[model samples]
Target: MDSLSYLNKYFLRYKKKLALGVLFILISNIAQVFIPIFLREGIDGIQQEVQYDKLFEYGLLIFVAAIIAGVFRFLIRQTIIVVSREIEYDLRQDFWAHIQKLSHRYFQNNSTGNIMAHATNDISAVRMYVGPAVMYSIDTVSKFIIIIAIMITISPLLTFYTLIPLPFLSYFVYQLSKKIHKKFTLIQESFSDLTTRAQENFAGIRVIKSYVREDGEIKNFTEQSEDYLNKTMDKVKIQALFQPILYTIAGLSVIIVVWAGGGMVIENLLTLGDISAFVIFLGMLIWPMIAFGWILNIIQQASASMKRLIKILHEELEIQDSKATRTIINSIKGRIEFKNVSFRYKNDLPDILDNISFSIEPGETIAIIGKTGSGKTTLLNLIPRLFDATNGDVLIDGYKIKEIPLKILRQNVGLVPQETFLFSDTLKNNILYGTKNGNDELVNHVAKISQLDKDVEGFPKGYETMLGERGITLSGGQKQRSCLARALAIDPKILILDDSFSSVDTNTEEEILKQLKEYMKDRTSIIVSHRISTVKDADKILVLHNGRIQEQGNHDELVSLGGIYADLHFKQLLEEELKELS
Candidate 1:
């Protein structure tokens, strides 16, 4: 119930349409109530004396009333149901926008399938409440009030007797509704799990095929499907009782009306027409009674879904521009400095990077070399503020990194991470992804610089070649080079390449590096790689060991030092000689 309060703003936004819908409900119900009156008059007039013209008048009046009611009923749906769809659109947009603003940590904690379930099933459930549940609630209330008032006008005693069973119906619905809400929450959770299983299976289909675990995966999915079916059956069993019990209660009221009103007619206290109208009014009340139960079912499901949505909407954004951010500092010259910075993903875990202090001048190319699990990538991530440092400060262009707006800071820095990801798009569009005004000229330039132009030219459609999902059509080295071209297309002032050349052969790697040497002459460049050949010619080299810099110098000086860098260099040289002999 509290979670449903989140929709108050949307209600206010569409209040005018809701008000018009209410007005239409009143008008429709008023017209519908008059049908019984005309029937009563016609029945009494026929008993008194047979007059064809009078009977025709009554029939015509009844027909007009029915037509009026039907028209307003259509108008009611036009206003109320239409507003529901509009609100659903707005809510979905808000959900998508909020998800985009959430930090990387949120994605790590949640699954893609769970989020997709929220976007599809959960949102549609809430829409049922916003549209159908709300519309029917008003319709049932207004119809009940109108029908009951007319019934009381016909005979106060009969109306009072028929309504005696209604209080019991209310109590029965209340108890079942509570159970329904709980069961619905469980069902929604199970649905999320089921959706996640299917999503993971699809995304990892290649892995399953590689391991030949199709039978095992199929068995697991079958188990999940059975679990979901059982939960749904449990909920359906509860709902199955709703209509039968509702009809039984409504039938009880009708019996009381017939028995009580028939006795009055026999005693000359009421006419035959009055008894007929009483029966008709009771029949109308049955629909409202059934609608009440259905509305409760929808409301319970919507409440459960809204609770799930609200939890995600309330997730705190870990990273955003703060009040201290400098709005005027729109660009940076790419002088990066790390002052005793240490970072850990969580406070309970050991630091991935510890006491890392380094500085890069505006136009120098600095290379970082370390074994796997060292903090080479983490150190570079701090420059672009991917993950904030746990202690100390990182400054860019002599300004604290946090002080710069994320948009401006990231726009000036181009990074090609170790894991290359490309969209299923045309080769030209993939290269031009982040640049707003990028033209063919810019795409061609970066492609040539990154040695991707040759591969694009070899394709049947050249730059227009459409890639498969995650660029699956390209070879490993082609994907890496394509990612490099994307980064270069942004025309960034600072370039960070995290092992971007691991897949390319030595000859191609040398060619790309030669091209980069001229392209990166004035831009600050940071390279993280395991290849000694890649970092040996940089202006300065930093060798990391166990989350700290072990050595810092040029290639010649590091070789003279006879330390970790020298040992790695010597090993790589021996491997190259062995490869040549082989």
Candidate 2:
């Protein structure tokens, strides 16, 4: 109940609709309450005299009341139930928008399946509370109040006797509701685990098949399914008691009405019609009692789900534009500078980039060559502010990266990472993904420069070919080239190629670089690669070992220095000579 307070704004947002629904509830109950009264009149009149016209009149009145109640009942659902769906849509949209703004670290910590469960199952549960639970709660309460008030007016003592079981019913439901809330929370958690298992298995199906672990995965998934089933059964067992307990309590009240009302009728203190009306009124009370128990179940489930949703909604954004950001500066010339930059993912971990200081001039092409774990990717990430430097400053065009607006900073830089990723979309759309209104000419130009034009031409649909999930339909080199074309489509001021050519042959790499040289003449370029051949002709070459720069020079100067770069170059030359001899 406390957790559900977050939805107060939504309630207020649709208060007019809710108010109309309440009005309809009141009108429907008002009409329904009179049916018992009309029954009493018809029964008494029939005993007094055999008058068919009078009897027909009472029947017609009862029929009219029922029709009115039914119509307004329909209106109640149209307003309240419809608003629930509207709120669900708004809530889902807000959840997705917030998720997009969350930091990359948030995704690393949370599983995709868990988030999906929250978006689907949890939101639906909350919608039940907003819709059916609310509607029925008002329906039950108003019906009870109107019926009980009328019953008391007819005979106070009989009404008192009939209501004796109500206090006990209330106490029983309160205790059961606590258990329901606890069980429901466990059920939601188990459901999340079950969803996560299914999602992971599907995403890694290829890996599982390659490793011949299908039987193992099936056994594991079966265990999770059984666990979810058991948790649900436990909740169902608790809920199953509700109907019988409510009906038993309602039955007791019915018995009391008959026993006490019959005695009064024998004494001539009450008529046959009064007893008949008392019985009809008591029957009306049964639905309210049953509805009370059902509403409690819905509330408990909704509360549990709302708590989970609130946990995600309350997560703070790790990186966002602040007051210090310079919003007026919408573009950059791409003179990137790292002033004693140092970074680590966490405080306790050793630095991946330790006191690295370098500056790239507006048009310079700088290449970083390093061993596998040499922090090359981490350095490129800082340029886009994907992760900020833990110490010192990263600047663009002499402005601190933090001072530049994030959207503007990122738009000015293009990055093609080592691991290529593509959406399940057309090749043309994938190539043009980075630009707002990229024409086919731009797409074709970038595709040609990245050497992806030849591959696209070979496909049956050319640029219209739809890729499989994560571009599984394309080869490794094709995916990398597609990613390169996407980066080029942006026409960014600073271009970063982080081992992006690892899959392509040396000839294709050479051709792409030859075209890139002209395209990058006025834009700053950063290349990170392991190949000596790749960095040999750069304006400047940087050699990194561990987390620090070991050498910095052009190919000839580094070879003359006889350092780490010279060793790598000699090894590559020897490998090439050996390949030619073979």
Stretches of candidate 2 exceeding 4 Å from the true structure: 1-3, 167-199, 228-242, 470-472
- Residue pairs with backbone atoms closer than 3 Å in model 1 (clashes): none
The lDDT per prediction is 0.89, 0.89
Our tally of clashes for model 1 stands at: 0
Candidate 2's residue-wise lDDT over 1-582, tens digit each? 999889989999999999999999999999988999999999989989979899999999999999999999899999999999998888889888988888876887787767888989899999999999999999998998899899988999998998788767766776787787788878878877888778788888899999999999989989988988998899899989977887788788878888999999999888888989998888877767656876888898899999999989989987789888988998899898889988898899999998888888998899999999989999898998778899989989999898999998888899998899898999999998989999999989999999999988889888989986654399999999999999999999999999999999999999999999999999999999999888888998988888788888888999999989889889999999999999
Which whole-number lDDT from 0 to 100 does residue 268 have in model 1? 86
lDDT of 2 at 138: 94
- In the range 215-289, model 1's lDDT, one tens digit per residue, is 999898898888888888888898889778877888898888889888998998889999888778877777776
Which structure among the candidates has the greatest lDDT? 2
Segments of candidate 1 deviating more than 4 angstroms: 167-199, 232-242, 470-472
Clash counts per candidate, in order, are 0, 0
Write down the TM-score of every candidate: 0.92, 0.92
